[model samples]
Target: MPAAYQPPVAAMRFLLEHVLDFDAQMAMLPGLEDVTSELAEEVLAQAGRMCTERLAPLNLPGDAAGTRLVDGEVVTAPGFAQAYADYVDSGWPSLAGDPAYGGQGLSRAVQIMLDEMVSAVNVSFGLFPGLTRGAAEALAAHGSEELKSLYLEKLTTGEWCGAMALTEAGAGTDLGLLRTRADPREDGSYSIIGTKIFISSGDQDFGNNIVHLVLARLPDAPAGVKGISLFLVPKFLPSGNGTPGERNAMSVGALEHKMGIHAQPTCVMNYDGATGWLVGEPGRGLNAMFTMMNAERLFVGIQGLGLADAATQAASSYARERLQGRAADGHGPVPIIAHADVRKMLLAGRAFIEPARALAAWTAIRMDVADRHPDPQARAAAHADVALLTPVIKAAFTDLGFETTVLAQQVFGGHGYIREAGIEQYVRDARITQIYEGTNGVQAMDLVARKVTMEGGEPLRRYLALIEADIEHAADHPLVPQLRDALALLADASSVIAAAEGDPDRLGAAATEYLHLFALVSLGWMWLRILAAAPALGDTRTPRGHAALARYFAAYLLPRAGLHAARIAAGPGPVMELDEELL
Candidate 1:
């Protein structure tokens, strides 16, 4: 069925070794001194094996079986529990975690590579650890010493998984509209009462306990978002010895019957006087939760990248084997891969997937630098770069990822639409990435409004400077000038959106387009870097292949930057003119 899923191990190693110089980068960061290229390669290789053997086979079966609520417990898809046990036993969850909390203390770049493999093979299975890692980060950053001592290790080790509970029926994006309540008690804990919807991995039978980071307002709290506070509410309260004791006052009210990721339990969580401890300072819950949300946003982007690569691989395999029309020479029957249109579709997907992988790797390495760089200036610079690119990665990767799946589906024609082919499943799974972790529209607005316009657009200026520097080095390349032009367009668009500070409508109108422009330029910048690194890739065929993809991206994809820039320059009037009741 559409050729068994294979991890892009060679491609990942190519980027890690030649393009990104990952080993040298890791050597610069603290706690990653021993992480070498050879070690990283071995880790990726082993992870690929595990995923191919243990996880890939589970993807379709998991989707078919889906998740169910047995009594009040959310039971995962078949074989998921054993797979998760094997995952934990293999020490994967601790790969990029903090050493103090039983993690292996590796660089996030390595972890991200592994993440891509897992997500590609089995996205439904990936959510379990993905959400737990996010929760651990939040708790590590803001939770009290006691909370950390009690919960951090379990979450880090995947002994007890974690979930984020921020959404309510009335509040999705607007946290201020939430009605969840948290009341303080005498024993330094609070009673959390709320119902959170769309909570991925909210409940699972695989892990010992689920540590839910719930958001609720206290009795004396102020109104709106400022009143909200984050609480660490476990499914089962930890006893005096840090073991699972009495069951907490919470239940999975229902499971969301969704379009995709059916194996992942998207629960409607109900907290009826659940005992919880405050995670951070009063009235600053959003600040704490954002630490997790920001991490999830980037991870979600990688999810898209993983699925995109999977779909491309599937379509390419099918095209190579499925005989169809004649070649240009009018031979008897040739594989569809010979067809110009099919080749174009496949190349387009490759053009996006390769550089997108590089971009994700680069961002992930920067995340490590931002956190662990010894120099304060280096840390601050890396942090700024990560902040500016997060929204772009989240929005663009998912949007294009979904499109890539559809393109892959197109390659198979009617066969792709059939469930038995397994291509349609990729399309369904890829759709949710664009919607969750804040929709792409929300991401676009964040890119234009807060990230671009804030501080007089300093972040955007610095990021563009990095691109310009890369372009300057690749002057001999044909795509150099075009890349420069796209960067300038992006800069100009940023300035236009920044200049419209007083007009909220202008920001809203330009946001999605502006994000698209930013993404194209960013990817173009990545392609330039890839082009420069091609000669050093050490193989004639590989260099030629990367060069072809780079050319395709410049010729076919980068031009969209202009369209988005034009839309951004159009202002908000055309979009705002239509009245709400006109229809």
Candidate 2:
């Protein structure tokens, strides 16, 4: 059996109500008057129960059985289709979609909480709806009304599924080099011919139809990324009545045998003269698809947070039950939880997971603000905040996610290496988060190159100002001093990177480390916000636990801020000094 996943209901509720102040934020977003703390709690509690009871049981089995390509069609692991049916029947996918598209129109923060619960229990299962929602959002934003009329409702309601087909064999991160072709036909659709690899939820056994958001080049278009265009292609072409009709000319060539997430199909997809309709304008596919990528990036970050927490829970539970060597007091053999080393591992996970969660929730609230805030200036500022922090969340959450799971597995001794205890499964499942949704390395480069350097670091400075404002909000809290110092270090580091205008090498070398530094500082700020909010939450275990975790994070984790800041100031010389041919 997989470990029992206890949804962090209280933690999520505390943050939604107290720290992030979701109630107040919701009130500001028009048409969101229906969202309340009570609704959020209910959604989380129900979603959590479903995840633990329904989804968690399938995790190991999914991993063991994996997905297969049989007779030119992909078949999902056993139990996945039923669980997904239940998931759809629960109306969960509609939580964050637009109200106009047969959805509940809930705030993005609530969806983030739900995502954490789903990911913690079964990440593979979660990808189906996750990609569907991503595709729906992209289509709703950029696709023509006729396309949305035909597809968005089905996608938003979980009647159909979606996939992002961006990478060709020749193009991984460099979309400009992609050779996928889209030749226009007189009927207004295009013939898409390309192969997209490593596609998550590319083809599966569950949903009725799969809608793919594809990137291809128009025959007469300009070269490079500027020539790319986004298209909506379906497994079975929709008839005039918007129902499945004749089969599209796309097929799953093969399934990827991967190191992790075996239940989720990582596919090699081929589109041979597939019919597709263009989205947005020609030569602007990147701009259109970014709508999906940005959303998926943050969602991937939360996946890391979920897996980290799940692993920690499994390891800590095992530690409490498995008797080991005698305690330091020389008594009989005690549960390993009595050992300080075990406690250290547990604390490390807590330190990172709690604040990382807060950061995700904070960012989710900003996503709502960016889209729905009444003031135009506030919306733009919120948009900037989202852009600046997305990569930090993506890279740091995943990198630390891998580390936390390893630490959790280490606490399990040899048992973690095997699958029986279920801890090892988390390790394997989490390994992919670092690699997909754009590798953490690419996220780091984007942080430095686009977010910081391109705009002369105005966004970074603005984010620092917001942190300082929060510091002022929590001025009386214990972590305030540490928060102030981190704020300063982040500000200084931003200046250093901004100053390196002509030095791409320096920017590239320091980018990853700088992102780590930024993430730590961001977490510290979150802890301070939690501390500030704890007192208002009344006498409860949630507040008490929040205080303890904040102290632990400040004492053990915030000190790394100075180290990263120092390295940022040192520039790229240490990294770039060596020649490529050096022994």
Candidate 3:
């Protein structure tokens, strides 16, 4: 078997304390004054213990056993129910929820740390609570007071779980194509009739109830996306006292058989005139749903970050122990770690994993600031930052995450291919991250077409300025100049795409490469920050380790930014030249 997951507690602490200065940042945000570095460390440490002891062992078994549909109910794999119960009893789900809604009200940065741990050990299990948190965020932002009072606490406390019912058989990314319909009732409720496919944790026996935030159109609603409206449809209608009461007119049509995350029940849901309530203003469903979708996009990015770390840990452990070819001294067979090629694969994974973790955490901190900062200007700036980086994180993190897993698998040679080695599971699980939460291709387009040009490109300019300021701080560092050059390339590419506003094909053709270029530069900037903070880390080995990885990233990974920039400059004609039916 592959080496068991070991949470990067020290590394996490180092980022929070030294590199990101998370505690200081939290102090500036309203209501997060008490979120100290020590508290964050303790929380991460305890979460790591829970994941290592309670959740990690369930991963392989859960995947092997998977989920099954029996008599219209989805039954989870063995031990999952009890594990979820334990998870709730320990109050794990309330980490970042609103205090008024029975949540601990911790900073999102801290919650994201816990999320990374959960995802690393048991991604299948993480989906159960992950979707709940996303639902709670949407409802908190747009749900009626009565709806929040009636359901928010239970959802926040994990007494109930939530699922997003958005995709239909014919609609995946295009919400405008959905045929689901909702009709208003005299009692202010609506009758929802639709089929939603690819709903994760759509139904489960573990939670007392499941609150589905569905997207549907009204009877007189306009055509396309403008007609869409958000609704809250519960599996069990709430009673006078708020407990689950009568069953709603909904059932699992079927559970999907997938390549990985087998323990997560991806369901096709049928809402046969299900009783529902409108979440936001009429004809504004997509707006409310995007609130949840945006949160999920960030959460999905962390999922990739978690898997990358897990796969890297497993491969590094194997490389240190597994004897293979002889060392340069021509002695007996030595550990694979001694081989140059094996070291390359391992270092490449590390180069991506460390910076990716930093970037995810950095984004989470900005999210908290965007939501909680007392200053309007600060909040707006943070919001702009979050909007600009969300798609990049979602796309690049998952793309590299899948690549890191495959690289780790390569390190195992033939052994990695087998089930017994366990590395193959990470590869299979990582594959889906790139495809879901809007495919990486779609995310790339969003980054280039919308976010880059949004506010007349002020957000992109602000982001580049931030990087340039930081580069100035470490001007003497060897990697700073490389990061500076990459930033310029990204800026030039952004301007190129922005200049082609009239041509849709230009944006489409340059989207993926531009996003890749952006991610590389962003990660390069992260490595520079790490190098600057290495001295305060207080240990020779730790600082030296970070310096080496920073060097490796500059030498091996950052150069790709140049290639992506070149591709972006190549324009769209070559891509658009081919006819649809041509051979």
Candidate 4:
């Protein structure tokens, strides 16, 4: 085995078996009757094997030799293309897609497990499958019957890959500023003319055809996002038999070298009246895109968790193996893990990793409910909960993920910065989680401005009540009150944000701290749920590490909630008071 990295079976099982309660979910979804914990364990074991065996071994080499571009095609690392082929042959992409479209009909929990595993082993490699899953979700949710029937199966089965074309040079987060245009043609199709940047897998040799879901404004359309419409613009046009035929009018004008995820090609696609068809209604493009965004954003949150998990493992292994200075109490030539400070760092890293992973996985479970719930009321409730949590999930988990990787790098002392070792890759890979899937800043805005502000705080009230209910259940624990206090502080922080809405500067002033406050409370809620599900000290294979890690969060992580709450409540005065010329 290559340096024996221990999977966080404890955290993984705690998430798979509790909090989201997989047993109960499987019981309800009869389609998954054959898919028991045994099967899941088997699958995860297989995932673990594939990740470590195929993916983990590539991290260092892929980083050393990165994905190269030649001519107009992007090349994956040697063996990566074949490994990706094996990934598809395993039907891993279909784990949670609708069975109607060649998926295995599993729930999102399974997808979460697969997500965490792939992310840990190789984040760049994971990007391909991750983006595809999100696009499949978008098509399933809003594509035309013809569109869905034609492309969904191929996408799910990995015959083709999916790409979301939303960002343009003029628009990153502000979709209203997008300059892409779509005009209807006589053949029940549209022609798109615009350029999209930051497109992942935009041009790759991994698949035969890449489906581009482009968002654009129609001719004579109104200004802003109101005129927006979604279009299915494939890289290649499909012939009569559903096989990709002629090259579309689109072309990859250029590819930008990003800070990380270099293995996943980031292209600037030039669409010059590309043959495309409108998806959903004319003026509802953003609405349809949100279907992809919601799921994709949560997955990005899990991406952060996965990177953090990788970081934690890399750090912990280094700790146990790398001999360092003597312990504070003269333990003598101790493993770095023996040092109190090192232990503190390792524990703190685990604290965030465990709960962050749990929250992300739970969010995916709620999404599965939104996908497969038997009752309408339950489905609607699940939808509301997902909407309420998605922003926080993406923002908080990814924020912590970045922090965890930093700590992991720090723990490596000098080895992390050196490219010969792969610890730096975790830091590099973790960086983009906060930048994409709606910047964490945008996520915070969505949480406070939209999700929380719904109907003057009905969503906020419902969320607060739910947190209080969790408090009630976990009251027996001493840590529960501290968490409750954090929730209350979050409420106050939200109130301050609401109070500042009229102040133009307040929005920008509170943006960062607003995200911080949001992360605190959302993580607090998640940690409480995780602690409540602490596993009994039963077996070697069982995951009972929650208690130790929960204690770590209580002492080290939870107190930061107070700081975030204070910063958010401090208002925009201090920030806004600074004269414009002071700099």
List TM-score per model, in order: 0.98, 0.97, 0.98, 0.95
**The 10-residue segment with the lowest total lDDT in model 1:** 535-544
* Ten-residue region with minimum lDDT total, candidate 2: 535-544
Task: Please give, for residues 1-583, the per-residue lDDT of candidate 1 as tens digits.
Answer: 7787777777777777778888889889888888876788788889999999999999998999999999898889989999999999999999999989999998888888888889898999999999999999999999999899999999999988999999999999898999999989999999999899999999888758889999999999889999999999999988888889999999999999999999999999999999999999999999999999999999899999899889999999999998998988889499999999999999989999888888988998999999999999899889888988899999999999999999999999999999989999999999999999899999988887788865666767888888888887784766788888998888788779878876789999999998888888888877877877756767532434887788888889988988998888888989989997994
Ranking by TM-score: 3, 1, 2, 4
Clashing residue pairs found in predicted model 1: none
Residue-pair clash count for candidate 3: 0
Candidate 1, superposed: residue stretches over 4 Å from native: 539-544
Model 3, 288: alpha-carbon shift in Å? 0.2
Top of the candidates by lDDT = 3
Cα error of candidate 1 at position 580, Å: 1.4
Error of 3 at 53 (Å): 0.4
Model 3 lDDT tens row, 278-304: 998999999999999999998998899
Which regions of candidate 4 deviate over 4 angstroms? 1-4, 29-35, 499-504
Show model 2 residue runs off by greater than 4 Å. Answer: 453-456, 473-478, 537-543
Q: After superposition, how far is residue 362 of candidate 4 from its true place, in Å?
A: 1.9
Clash count per candidate: 0, 0, 0, 1
Number of backbone clashes in candidate 1: 0
